[model samples]
Target: MRWSRHPRCVSLARAELRTALAGWGLLVLEEAAVLVLSELLTNAGQHARVSPGREIETRFRPVGDGVRIEVHDASTVLPEERRPEYDECGGRGLILVDALTDCWGYGERSGPGKMVWAELRAGSG
Candidate 1:
């Protein structure tokens, strides 16, 4: 599913994750799913620089051995994890996502903008 970068979209992603797991015995992964959503949503809002009325898109797909979550935003800039200052109190969200996800990265889209993606192992089931 895709969503606008609007703030409420974060909650919508969470709800979809919950519904997907309903009675599927995948509930245990809810926190991880939510964390992934939070990090990607924050990235979309912070870096997408999408103008008002423009939209950011998200998609979830079943990969070969896992599930892949991707966030597509209007910005072409790829995400990079930079070390923040010791006194910095923010900007570590992607670091956390990297640690939790089996693999994660960003790539430029064919036409315009970029897509950031993360994957969780399926055998984890």
Candidate 2:
């Protein structure tokens, strides 16, 4: 699914993911998957320095017995995981994603940007 670079797309993507997981009988992974998607999409929206109106894209699928969540944006900037200071109120999105997902990473996409993705198995958090 393609989403615009707006805050509302976060909730919209979550709703779609919820339905997709339900249909795939992967409810056990829903909570963590939702959080993962949120962080990824938010990071893309906040940090993807692309031309205006360039839309971010999302893909939800079952990989083996797990679910794969991919967020594609038109920016080549990759996300980094950093330890936030005690006094900092931001910059912990990727940290949360790493803790929640079984494995997550970013790579080149077919087009002009990169895709950030996370994979979650049924029993993982």
Candidate 3:
């Protein structure tokens, strides 16, 4: 689904993802999936420089024994994993993603944007 580049989009995406995973009988990955989705959507809302008329696109699909989540934005800038200082309040999104997901990466979209994606293996917990 397409989401506005606003902070609320993270919760919206999480709700949709939770519903979808429940419907698919993949609740085993629900928590991790929601967290990863939140990070991806948060990055889109904060970093993507799309026009006012554009929006971030999020997709969820079943892949093998897990689910793949992707967030598409209008910016080509890829996300960087930063080593935040000890007292930092933020900048750990990707770090959490790395620890939670089976794998994660970003790639250029066909047109003018990039797609950041992560996969959560069901029953991995």
TM-score, per-candidate, Cα-based: 0.83, 0.96, 0.95
Candidate 3, residue 64: Cα displacement in angstroms equals 1.6
TM-score of candidate 3 versus the correct structure, residues matched by position: 0.95
On residues 1-125, what C-alpha lDDT tens digit does candidate 2 reach at each position? Answer: 99988899999999999999999999988889999999999999999989977899999999878899999999998898989899999999999998888899999998999999999998653
lDDT of 1 by residue, 56-99 (tens): 77777655555677888878777888778989988888888888
Give residue 114's error in model 3 in angstroms.
Answer: 0.3
Between candidates 2 and 3, the TM-score winner: 2
Model 2's number of clashes is 0
The lDDT for every candidate, in the order shown, is: 0.77, 0.93, 0.91
lDDT of 2 at 109: 92
The root-mean-square deviation over C-alpha atoms between each candidate and the true structure, in angstroms, is 2.4, 0.9, 1.0
Against the true structure, candidate 3 has what lDDT? 0.91
Q: Please write out the lDDT profile of model 3 over residues 1-125, one tens digit for every residue.
A: 99998798789889999999998889989988999999989988998887897789999999878899999999978899999999999999999999999899999886779999999987576
lDDT of 2: 0.93
